[model samples]
Target: MITKNTNLFVVSNVTNLRSRVNKLYIPKTKSLLPLFEIVSNSIHAIFEKREIEDNYQGKIIIKLIRNGDESTLKELDFIDKYPVKSFEVSDNGIGLNRENFISFQEFDSEKKAKIGGKGIGRLVCLKLFSKMVVESIYTENGKFYSRNFEYKKNIKEGFDKYENPESEKTITGTTVILENFEIEYQKKAPKDLLDIARQIITHFQLYFIEKVIPEIIIRNQNDEEVNLLNLFKSEFESEILDDTFNIGNYEFKVYITKSFNSLSHKILYCAHERTVKDEGLSKYIEDLRYIIKDNDSLLGYHYQVFVLSKLLNEKVNEERTNFHFSDDEEGDSESDDDITLARIRRETLLKVEELLSSFLSKTRKEKVEQYIPIIQSEFPNYASVIEFNRDKVEKIPAGLTPKELDVKLYEIESEWKLEVKIEGIKLLDEKKDITSLEDYKKLYDKFWSEFNEVGKTDLARYVVHRRSVIDMLDKLIKWDSNQRFYNEDIIHSLFFPIKEDKDTVIHEKQNLWLLDERLTFNNLLASDKTFNQIRQLNSNSTDRIDLIIRQEEIFDKATLFSEDKFPNDSFTIVEFKKPYRNDYVLGDPKKDPVRQVRKYINEIIDKEIKSEGRSIEADKTTPFYCYIIADITSTLEYILREEMFTKMPDNIGYFRFYTSDELKYKAYVEVIPFKKVIKNAKERNKVLFDKLNIS
Candidate 1:
């Protein structure tokens, strides 16, 4: 009964299949591509059955069998998780007839064009699993028969056909078994059954909603099955959008659904009633607007929009997984339409981006509108803050709707006020001349504990303020080609203003953190003329070092620095020059910054400027760190090059000096470009900002 003819194309060369399979495209993040292949073939079989019989009960059952303990298994993104060992997908569809069997035996078979078969999906199966076991029953010449075969990467012998003499009629069904997963599939394999099932539902949302729906069931080893269609229907919300897009007589259907119990929002492109390509909607959201916040119902909103069109289908590449819009594939369209595929793809992407951006903007605006009144009602004191900064609030970020701008303005204003109110109070209290570090520590702990809400606001406020400062500094440095020079006094005050009494700095610690985080330690902090009294009684002139900063901890009873390359035990000197200042780059006849700082170093070593009877440690051999920051003029570059000042990574320069004294004093000098410090500090702080969830 099982007869073969010229239509049954047999490959004598197995190496051709190997060569073709190697040229296939595979996605890395999604582990469902292989299963999608098998399932797609099953769907095609179901479609073939529908062609034969009007009322066809098409069922695709997928079983995920595990070798290890199921309880120990978790989600793929979860910390404690492992891949499943095996899987079995069976379908009640039209069996392998002569044409289907011939299609199977040959590579790139064209038998399933009615169901959008690419003829190369089977190769994806081999890529994921070690081998595929196929069993099918078909009627040939009105006689019942079964075909059993194993399709591995490379097989020498072909399938063995068996005749079912007991039954004259064929049982219409096919079963595809995939097991013994190799390392490639096992590495990124989905471990949680439900999570993958949800991904499948999203991936094939348009497929399930098609006219002839196929029931796909995913089950675990325990026989707990999840009917994907039922899950989708029960949690389905109202349709977000349903409309047709027409471009030059080439029309595409754009349908969107918002549903509950879903993890992600996706934009899937389907051609011929099958999902050919997909990407997360959150990706586009992040690329264009703000990220979908991670919350409960507010964040977990699931959406899927399908773009169905023959134009897109024709552009689909050989793999059918991606569109063929490359430059090489252009100028050869035999269709009556003359528009290029790349142009269509570009127009489609732009249109999709614009539509999604509009949708998100409107939706977020509505949410913000609802939330604004509640925030206003709860925080009555916010009005004064909002009123005071009305001008700043009015100037919102571009592209935001009026309502979105209102909500953002409220958040911005409220946070600024709370930060200032809390920080200002703390500064006022600290100015009362606390006698000891112990008292200051107690006050610090009390402030944080008492103003817990403001503490949270301050964390974000610090990042926002630091980011602004950096941007402001950038503008000052690179504002015009004329090389405008900002006032040095203005720059100093922009960072901090020394209390006229020289007690402490008051411009918020974030600016200090920008300079060097060590500058933020409340211990012995003074800026500009605050330290006028601390100047050394040198030979002739008077020029004080910009900053005397170091890390100290009363609790540790020792220096807080670790035993690394250079500890923070020594007194540190930092000098900042205006970006336009060329004086520091002068030669020996002029005032050299190196000698200026060396003078400060010598003064600190010899004079012993006291701090409450405890002087800064300075034996002859005590190490000192000096940092000079300015624009890299020619003389400074020459000095650095001649002094063997090795350039460390990230535009940092280092030079060491050992005065050949009896005690051999040590000095570590670092001269860095002001722009590099500003840029690197801002960039590095971005990680901390993200970690802290700061705006």
Candidate 2:
């Protein structure tokens, strides 16, 4: 029997009734956000597995299985006058015992002051369901104790008179069942439940991949495991990250061993699979704007930060260094101590927010905007903002010339000066001319030549120039193609490592790679034909090849070709270096020159093989021959030689280097056959240079 009066504190023989009851409460506005609270709390519990028990493994399983039993739904309809759809979730995790259970009841308590601090996850159930039934079998001094949560007609009376059940079994897990879920206000049942589950799995992929290796098997009425990850090939991920990052008080790590597809518009996950995108970023900005306005009086790093990234195995726990000491340490000074603690916690939170902001910003800048959709698909509340004070900030014009655009874009976005960032790109949809090969060539030649030198030259400035050129070209290409700049496979293919391929062959007719997705050489061949038409007539020896450089080694070596002339009758090997320093060339040629040159040669060979797959005869080898040509000449003679013959790499070789200066000289002086200069020059050059009038 239970009784309640004016002094409504209920009493029982239970050791921690006050604590347990304090842990349970109804949230002010129970919504989807509250569900996040529950999962976050569970994640915290999993994180503490090591601290709480020996041989503890970080594992937490949350299974939501819809109930088929019509009795419960019908019974509630008849008696409670409420339609209910219930779910049962079970996990084989360390259970919450009496003391912890009591703390669970407390409001805003810091018993477990980790990610789930403030003890609000339990309230999530209140938001999701009209009725909840929670059962826990945990140890109480070697004896087993059980607890139950039953809904009462009056919520206040129910809370005051909650009861405990007696049990003999000592199990180490808790189960929660929720019923009568509804969508009210901004809270609604997800249109796609499976998608919701997939998003959860994806956002927390690194977590499952590292610790729990969760097996999320969805089944139909037949009870067969359906692979949600496999069903969505676009969302299928086979590659994983090994990279890790460390901040002052946090060690961040991410991986992607498991895969899942998200159908929800955009849901934020603490352990995320990808970075948030523009749509999500826009939402985040709106939310933050509202928050800032609502709390106008609050200042000094007081903000709510939402983290959405693939930081799965990152652990954030309280540490000894969290406490700081001041010079004055004389007395108890209780108020001072409290103030210091509060300040430390506040700072910690601020640091976390800063890290998240930095990560999302970096990702947005470095990656393609198409990927932005994927991120936005996962997290809807991570938006970008260009904070402006109309009184202090000035609007800049966009019609600025390339040089001016580069300078102005930098000035506006630089951290020290104007914080000018382009967030959520929105451009007018218009058709433009197909990008001209001449324009592409001019853009490449102008910027890359300056970027080749590092350490000794103005590398930073050169790189900035290269980046400007790339951005310009990228935009132009996208405009011409009528597509987002990054969506073009050609753009990403140019930068990312190329996957190996077969079946590509060289045809005598085209002089270009026969059929390979990765090789852009074919396009270059076609473009050359168009560009050749408008060129001024020049002797065959005067034929010129223009190149864009990207690394310091190239610039350092760029002048080397001035010392050597091109070998007669050999294919020229043009190498483009990876982005590196440019201001000053490093003097230690022995260390980086060989390694860097090797990489360049390997890329050339890889492209060649991928492009000319089966063209070479199986038996008759025609002593493959080629020449080494680069804007730079930092590689030593031995390195160049090794790269040249290099056993022919099973295709083509017997190559030599012609310094850019030598090639330039040859362009003006030599009267050699244009056919002899570039491979397949006879036919392809007509297509490439006929318009240029080279005779």
Candidate 3:
């Protein structure tokens, strides 16, 4: 019978244990966390025993239970082990005494608070397993006692048939049977013995580093036993470097070690001797993206850094999966500076980089050596920037592709330019004090050095652009798979855009320099435009010239066609024919390119040309230079011969001088093949390309 007190209310236990379990978050990948928790409890119990008895040795045995079906065994053709069903962990430590029994019955108990126990490991166990059964024996007041209990979800009191001190027991130990692994979690759990052992080692690696781990053994149904202590010593043990750092008032201890089994360098955050969070070291130090290989032994290794601090222990959530603080520094309050995980990690990585300085320096040097040639041959624009900023280049990660390297070098160059700009401004500042004549001279010289280097980089970029244009022109003139050549408009647009004039297209957008460097300084230029459309010509005829240029003494548009224009002002008419085109009809002004140029020049001389109603200063003595760019086919060669044009000494082109009696002027004409254009352009830019060391 139960008696009711006069109190208005009383503290009550949770009614629905399943709802409590559902509230906890357990990721599928972390299905083994339940097993780790039970093992951690056993380890803590052993620590409790050691405190009482000095000579006592701690030992734990984990038994694996698997499904024994003949059909399932036959179906697994390659697997030697069956799927595990449950696990039974036994520890010869202080069993559940009366005080511990009371603590176990309550939720959120603080009995094991000194050892970092959150009093919810058993709840975590029920998340994966269907039931938990415990049997233990302990001595109280010089007398041996026994306890037995079974925890299941369906039980109203969370446990059934609780027997305390029911009968006498000889020894003291506890065996927890976590039975009936749920199918959802069992599929995610590791099936192999070695894999399971590795998970345990990784989880409790901090304990192993502290030399406080106990003797743990894993046994399968086949009686195969694995001593975890031996596994740690042979495979995971290494020379460890221990150090300490501080973030604000919180102190942190770090343990750095090398492991052959690690695929990449890692940083693990620990709280209460258990790793709660981890991040790849490559996220901070890119050189550690892959394992570090040893030349002498041909073995690859990577670092495993463990960080422990009291603040981390206090901030650890009840699930021990993460901390209460934010992961990013910005997520925390501005008044509290060092409470975020990112802040702690940044400081910790600084120490890690300091400790691995020698290894990192060697690897960085090798990376820079491999990258120098790539910049010289493929990215000449960054050569000077990289040479001056070697320290920034060393900070870049290794194993980058050409495209990635281009982006990194571009970023570095932009930063260097900004620095140079800032320095130049400071040097010319009126408020800056002139300490001495030598100091001022030194500052001025340094500023000019960086400024000149920037200028050289811009020039190199322009040279590279020229090389690309030359290559494109060479490819455009080649025959296609269909045995046909590119049309005239395609080639015409390469030098100057069709239907556009100098007023619409800037000099930088046109490649007129490929034909003649002097053409780039034209006072007026037009492509694919009729005589009537030109502002400098007053002719009403609609004959479209392929390309036309007019040069004057002064480059002012107002004086381009004024009466003050120089007598030496000249006119250039260029015509483009399809590559390898042999369909030329002699004396047909439309078909014959030479006659076409002559007709356009005759109209220009006959017209009353003026700018803003001012008489043009041109006379019959003004020179006319005409060019026809096309391949020297058989039919075109005959046409050139009939025009009295003499072949060039190289036999690649033809040139002639024609005297016009009606106009009283002399005209120079040339028929240049496509090959000669590419060859001459390359010859003109060879010196610059050689200086930049580019192909």
Candidate 4:
């Protein structure tokens, strides 16, 4: 069963061969990665032939066999529809001579070590297929020799050979037949010619560009051929750079290019001019695009980044799909040396990514800058619209697609035209020359209504700003440190002034907005200075009230709900207390928070407190809103329970009280704890802050 002339190299213990090769990893996406291994050897064999015959032209043909099972045959009318059965690769290279067969017998052979070859390409084929048939012819010792054999897992371990000095022929080549595709590898194969062709072009782009690689032809059962050289020629018309850079002891040559064909932006990693890894850099470029603008219209150019380094081969994993960790950083050793090397490797990769990121962003911006002047000169108003959109852009605003831009361009044109007309109308003389008062009022009302929407926007922004301030104030309530706290005056200064020196500076600025935000809309007559301390105090003056809020007819701020809006007639009286001031909560009838607000109401109802000749009037026929802010102490809780304030309604703070008559004078009493107010403000304000995308 064996020929004496050809070397019948027997691998010692075939099971050991299987066990050894099985340890090598093969990734799922690269089931057909064996094609690279097979072709690479063919290229090497071709080079061997070139050493003897310099004019030799290497040629490799790859053919795929389709399945003819009944299920697969049912789609006879379909094109390129059959599931793949096998692959055959034939190369006009120096055949599998004695030297080659010798190298194949060794484990981790170093014969091609200098050229970055591991001499284990056969494992890739064995992993993906059930069988291989090798046939080759070559001149050895001036004799024509041929070796032919059926290769299969767990089968005969050696090849059969035939030879004769008189049988020299004109042709010398090797044919490697791969059949019986493993079941797991079937689905990942690209059945379409274009798809597989693109994969090959992407995988072997660096090879085609740098080396005189053999002319590779791929064909299926349909007999369509894709020429690798022509494919590369069509796409790789330009090269941006071919330069070397160093990282540590490893020198890496990087090649960049712009493609006019079906090439994605990728950084291809190669070992000895053969691709070892590749990854598309689109995601990294996308990061830069998002930082520049949220708009989706910013598409960077199609480019390629190829890098070759012996370090790739030096650091390859068992699978060769990934690089291994640096020597000092392997396994689970807790040595400081491991940590240092690991950190260095990680930082090195990150630095490389950073460099690529800078290059992509600069190139993309330069490409887009060319069109800026043309866009601005022809569409000035649209330019303004773009700037406005950019100004209002949040951290993650929705990006604009082409269709959205088409719609937005029309909206921008119409809005700016309306703005031009409004400016024209403001130049009209009809306001001063109106013959009737009703016409003047009509014009005023029309303009005012148009301006009112701007007020609504301002109101929304006010809510957001106030919420931010409240969120900051929340940290102060339980702000105890080393048994220390903000004294009563420090917390009081945030709402209303505590010290007399700050009275002039803090006037009308009431930051304590616990009752409702609308309570802030009212005008302030006096705060802390008290009704009695005024320059011209009337008979109704009372020093007990901490704050006397005045509601005038119209003001700069908007009023919402029934409290601050409509009628605008009530006088809001407030009594703020330091939460630590438990003396105010004592049952000594005069010190109760409830009794204090009622006293202010009686003073306002009994007499007119005039401020600079403007009489602040309140009586049983006038409304008085009394608000009391203090700790919800035990004594106050008992008083609230006793006063039947337990059945208080919703949206109302806590307790309800009427001064003499409910129709004329009203007061809502809420004894709030500092902790509750701080927690509520933190919760509510967090929502607003998150909505605005603030950190």
Query: Tens-digit lDDT track for model 2 on 167-198?
Result: 66655656665555644512333423455555
- Tens digit of lDDT per residue, candidate 3, span 624-650? 878899888888888888988999998
lDDT of each: 0.61, 0.35, 0.79, 0.59
Better of 3 and 4 by TM-score: 3
- Scored against the true structure, residue 537 in model 4 reaches a CA lDDT of 44
Per-candidate clashes come to 0, 55, 0, 0
* Structural similarity to truth (TM-score) of each candidate: 0.44, 0.35, 0.72, 0.48
Best candidate according to lDDT: 3
Q: Compose the digit string of candidate 4's lDDT tens values, residues 138-162.
A: 7676676776665555444533333
Model 2 ranges off by over 4 Å: 1-84, 151-154, 157-161, 183-187, 191-193, 202-206, 209-242, 245-695
Best TM-score among the predictions, by candidate number: 3
- lDDT tens digits, residues 1-695, model 1? 13233234333334455555667767656556778778877888888888888766889999886667656533323422446767788888888767787677666676654345767677877776777777777666666566656676654332323332323445677888886776766777778877778667765666766645599999866666789888777554243456565667888777776543345666677777766777665553433223344344364456566777887778776556677554554454444456564444444455555556666565555554554464353333334444454444433444555456547766776676577677758667666667999887876764454355445545655565676677777776654566677765556555555322234444353265655666565344334432445432222324455666544543222444455533334555667667756654434623466766677666556654555555555656465667777677776777667656777676554455645565335677777676777876767798854554332
Arrange candidates, best TM-score first.
Answer: 3, 4, 1, 2
Model 3 clashing residue pairs (backbone): none
Candidate 3 residue 350 C-alpha distance from true site, Å: 3.0
For candidate 2, give the lDDT of residue 274.
22
RMSD of each: 21.6, 27.1, 7.2, 17.2
